[model samples]
Target chain A: MAMYVVGHKIPDSDSICGALAIAYLKNQIGEEAIPTRLGDVSPETQFILDKFGFTAPELKMSYAGEEVYIVDHTEKTQAPDDIDEATVVGVVDHHKLGDLTTSTPLECWIRPVGCSNTIVKMMYDFYNVDIPPAYAGIMMCAILSDTVIFKSPTCTTADIKCVEALAEIAGIEDYKALGMEMFKVKSAVQGTPTRDLVMRDFKDFDMHGNLVGIGQLEVIDLSVFDEIKADLAADIIKLKEEGKRHSVMLLLTDIMKEGSLMLIASDNETIIADAYGVTVENNEVWLDGVLSRKKQVVPPLQDGFANA
Target chain B: MAMYVVGHKIPDSDSICGALAIAYLKNQIGEEAIPTRLGDVSPETQFILDKFGFTAPELKMSYAGEEVYIVDHTEKTQAPDDIDEATVVGVVDHHKLGDLTTSTPLECWIRPVGCSNTIVKMMYDFYNVDIPPAYAGIMMCAILSDTVIFKSPTCTTADIKCVEALAEIAGIEDYKALGMEMFKVKSAVQGTPTRDLVMRDFKDFDMHGNLVGIGQLEVIDLSVFDEIKADLAADIIKLKEEGKRHSVMLLLTDIMKEGSLMLIASDNETIIADAYGVTVENNEVWLDGVLSRKKQVVPPLQDGFANA
Candidate 1:
């Protein structure tokens, strides 16, 4: 008689929305489906929640002792305090598996399509739940976040199905038009705080076969970043002092131009220096002509990490 | 020869990724697509970029005084600093239209389903671009954000199509499995700042007749919000003084038991007295048997706003 709370990691619209949707579904099936969070949500996540009128989820450090299920994120369900030694009764999600260890078997619904939200949307479609406007907004937010409104390469047929269904439910006059407006509105971020800036744009990478973290900050007008660059550099220095494997890389990129001005701070200064052939000034330095960090910086970083 | 840079108001993954995808697509079709941001990204966004080894985006205040063929945002091509005056070359999006004004018609692909990223993915699918692993991860992230991983009603058939296509192109062994992992990453404020606690989970509301703003902050663990109830009250009081609205209410909800602790900060304090027969205490209060803000609190707020 234990309820399971679950969600995705480093959550965005999909993980948060999927958790809520599935929790609602589990409630219908007579199970206490607790929608849980593993970390703080991104700015886009608030948009998703507000769109759905879903009260943002309560945050938890991990899902170790509680009876937890997985969603959106892959396998980091190793919380020993909350979800300890318990079996997950039901599970549904879409993402690559990370670090998960379970002692018991459970009902896992993992689809290889677009989004896990799509699966839950299908469930709602099958059950004929009245698609609320707020929920519709949340669904659309997830689609936008996950697929970048279908620009990224991880979308699928099932994801598209859910989008259409949600659109129909939303009674959208013209989705394509709205999509642009929404995106345009989302793109404008004039005076957000430094902390918010840090959390908005990020990515993951494999550093010499070990998981590493890299982040980006796009300042359309480098003036905004220039004002805060010193503070940002200080934060990176602190992170480096903590001896973490992650690298804090900032790209003063000009959207109107093809090149970027890169700023990097890492513990292994030599590692970064060797990779980019750049010098560090006061534990901070900038790189120019950087457009594709994945295609460029990461490769070299990985090479350095591997060589080390 | 000039490229237009656009970002959403809150700038989610879609806002940034869509900008990039649309820009890339436009460039393919021989147009300059600039990835612009209204403001900077948050730490979470940086994480996504870091994972993908990318930058946030160039900051662009507005689309005013711009001349470019917009894509993936709106169909109204002549949105002069509004959703109405921009020139749209192509409208490949997945959002419902709202108060959108179009001076002239354009070739708009306003699909009622799927994420805009999926539309961009379709184009990429056509081109058969080799999606890097991290970029693949971002595409997945966008899908998760947009569809809530398929939980919300805004999803569509097109979203699913993109998801399947992306999973293949991204080389995901099991898309669904990965989704579970991603979704399991929880998003909540455990040690967040008082301001963040109040604002992070907030959602803006368009009061029935008035279109100002209303936000809700759910405190799943009532104790946490209660700890800073006084400070939160002060913040709300400040909000009332600064905002141009009659009522701005905050619902400190506990989702586990479907109950709420309400906090009202507005000019019309009697609304709380009239609606729930509760006296306002230093602009802080609570409501019994109140679970859903939309279901309960908003109606009273709407009535209060309307009558006022």
Candidate 2:
């Protein structure tokens, strides 16, 4: 049977590229695997795929009775809805270990790094399989996107080294220029729907019995979002009601400014206020020098809900 | 602060040697680590360590404020009593993913091989660190013990290849002879107490809200346990009552005959009887070709209880 390689929902560049690269590696090692995604590709990811000469992965929402190899994330909330019916054969991730359990022994390769593509690069080296140049190009772009162009605090030396090596393999002389070009595509929000922007990188987390939805939108400049912050906040309120979530937040992150403007829509704002030790005004707050959500935003919210 | 490298309770050869080898590798990579154990070293493990000129690791039962790297097991039932209070920085194992969650990104290396020592050997290769002769000898012995000298169904080609590589490093030409020697040490039960024999290699599992304790003793001849079978049953009953467990079982496995004589002491015999589809007689039943407690035993019982 062909195994499916997949990543979390609200697929980001790293998740999509990691799935594609891992499926390619597994096939090279004599296993038939197909890359899959839980959601639609965002504009940034679409740009990288077109630039690197690759198509988006097949959209697969359910995995009943199928075999899968999970990548990028381990949380049950981020998995397919019927994931309990599928068998997880392996996992390659770069996050805190979440509440995912497997019945049989599995191949798990998890590490503390900025990007899942770094671990995928390590897997290629482990198997001594040469990656094709196009795969290397997308993987490099994934690292650059995930680490916010090496500005996120989660960026480690291993991630930096992997991006450089991947760039060399892809025959790209100026990878930084390529990263800036990709972020420029990400910052385009002129005609896109507000709800689409809010759901661009959204995920639901079960924090102490409360379901919280968090999203991020990275751009080169913060001024572009000054016109639609009210619309984003209203859309988040609708999202919270529809999903029956305790809170919904969207982060408008300016990569060049190295900060995030957080828009909050919640049942009670005290949780977020007390968690970050900041007061919220007008349903929004400016978080200085906060770029990485996995490292900076989620942990304190988890702690806050846990204590509450 | 020095990180502690430890294994699960009931310190078997694989668990003990894996802790030592991983701690050594971490130290070689410039991290300060100390090997620790949750229980006393069994006679078979002691023999292997003494032969390899290494001492037993320090006994540590709690890890309240310390950082740890778990080996051999991932289940919460097998972890330290205060595992929730400690920080798990990494895990290296060859078992099913268990219910252990961490709040921080960790280094996890889990594979579906026969033994944890095989994974440790791969880790040694991963870091390009040379293994000491003593470590190699003990690691080879651990592989032999866990895989039952390649007779176990769980033994894979990777495990055999690792043992061969480790044996060459340990300067052992006839590794099979050394394996037989280790089993001989494991088969000795003339003067050992019934409780000690039962707890030699025991672990507890949560089977659908029922805590089940299972132990295994591998020997060359099953007849050696004929005289103490009744005493072993009584001890298991006592263990079940004392620990408030739903059931306790002991497998007297004859390695040469390639079968096991399972003794059951349970709150309800139908659970085990229906699991393996066998009719129990006098609290014991002979199982043909059941050398692996992990591959052949646990999965069926877990499924049986889940269905029941």
Candidate 3:
């Protein structure tokens, strides 16, 4: 049976590159698998794909009645639209286990690392398959993006070790320069569409039957948020209305400052206020020392929804 | 910080032996960890411990405000009483992810292998730690018990490979003899108390807010169940009443016939009848080709409960 290897919706650099890397490794071990994407690639992911001389994976909106292997995520909502109908053969992820259930037992490799590519790199080593330099380059870029060049709090020693080893394999001598190049593309928000900006790295969650969506963008400066604050808030409202999410948030993460300015658009403003324990002023609030979305953004929203 | 390595409640041989083996490997790697059990040990696990010259781990009823690394199972109901209050450092398991949520990110190694001990055995190889003969013997017994001597449908190639390697390490030339030796101890029901017989290898699950408990025993002969059928039913009712379980079941698995005679005590008998499409005959029914509790028994029961 043909197997589709895909990442989560609103594909980030790590999910896109990690899916490709795992597909490559699986095919090397005599499996019939091909890389696919659940959503359009972000600019940073597109830039990395171009730099590594690889084409973007074909977009797969659904996998009904087919075999698929998920990478970078295990959440059913973030997976392909018809994930419940598909036969999930395997999963390689680096996130909290969401409400994804499989009818049959399958291989799953989940680790608490910074990037899903870190787990894929270990899989290559375990299978004794030599990773191609292009795959290594993209994998390295994914690690850099997900870990925010080792500045994110989720960065671990294993992530650092894998970054160094993968960098060596990719013949990357100046890791900082490569990371900055990727970040330059990530922060190029001038003239970008407001909807694209809000949907770049979006993730949807089901918190006690409430649909919550959070979008994040990391940049070296916070002035970009000041320039597009109103438009971003409008886009958030539009997205929330269209998707019927209980809350839609956009996190303007200042990587250099290790803080985020969160813009919220929801029917219930008290949920946001109670979530972060801060007044929602002008539909926005500054959150100091909020770097990791999985750790910082999601849990409190869940708690707030629970309380509400 | 002291790390208490623990297994799930209703500790089977795989869980009990896997916890001890992981604690041994962790301590060898310059970490302070001690194996602990959430519930009393079974006679089969006790037999393996005795054969390996090891003592049963101290009972750890709660892990309130402590650091812990869990093994064998990851379901919150199977975990310690105060798992939500504990800081989970890591997890090494082989079961489906349940409702166990950690406050912070932690290392989790979950695979699709049949036995948790198979994953622990791989860790020994990964860390380059030579397994002691005693640990190897116990690990072998764990694999044998969990996989039902490679008869259960959950048995994978990894489990078979680990069983063979562990058997070699334990210097056992005849794996069948060793497996039968273990099963003989498991099926010894004569003169045993009714509660002990049913509680030997029991597991409790919260199926959509319903407290469901299943107790299983693998026997070479079916006559043993005929002798204790009435008492087994009585004990199931008593345990369900005392434990406040919504439903309690006893699976008398005849390994020789590769089927199970299920005795169920529940407020709703139609759920079981609808789950397997078999009529409930005097509080029991014969289930042909039902070898795995996880793959066969639990999933259908869960579906039945959901429908109910």
Give lDDT tens digits, candidate 1, residues B232-303: 777766766676555666677654444666677766568656766677776666676565443355456555
Model 2 is docked with a DockQ of 0.81
**In terms of DockQ, which candidate is strongest?**
2
**Highest-lDDT candidate:** 2
Candidate 1, position B103, lDDT: 24
Going through the candidates in order, state the TM-score of chain A alone for each one: 0.69, 0.99, 0.97
Worst 10 residues of 3 chain B by lDDT: B96-105
lDDT per residue (tens digit) for residues B1-308 in model 2: 89999999999999899999999999999999999999999999999999999999999999999999999888999999899778899999988888888767899999999999999998999899999988999999999999999999989999999999999999999999999999999999988988999999999998878999999999999889889988998999999999999999999999999999999999889989898999999888999999988888888898788778
Docking class of 2: high
Pairs with backbone N, CA or C atoms under 3 Å apart (clashes), candidate 3: none
Better of 2 and 3 by DockQ: 2
- TM-score against native, each model: 0.41, 0.97, 0.91
Q: Candidate 1: fnat, from 0 to 1?
A: 0.00
Q: For each prediction, how big is the interface RMSD?
A: 22.2, 0.9, 2.9
Tell me the lDDT of candidate 1: 0.56
Worst 10 residues of 1 chain A by lDDT: A96-105
lDDT of each: 0.56, 0.93, 0.86
**What is the C-alpha DockQ of each candidate?**
0.01, 0.81, 0.35
* Candidate 1: stretches off by over 4 Å: A2-4, A62-64, A75-86, A89-93, A111-114, A122-133, A156-158, A176-191, A200-211, A216-226, A250-263, A267-308, B1-308
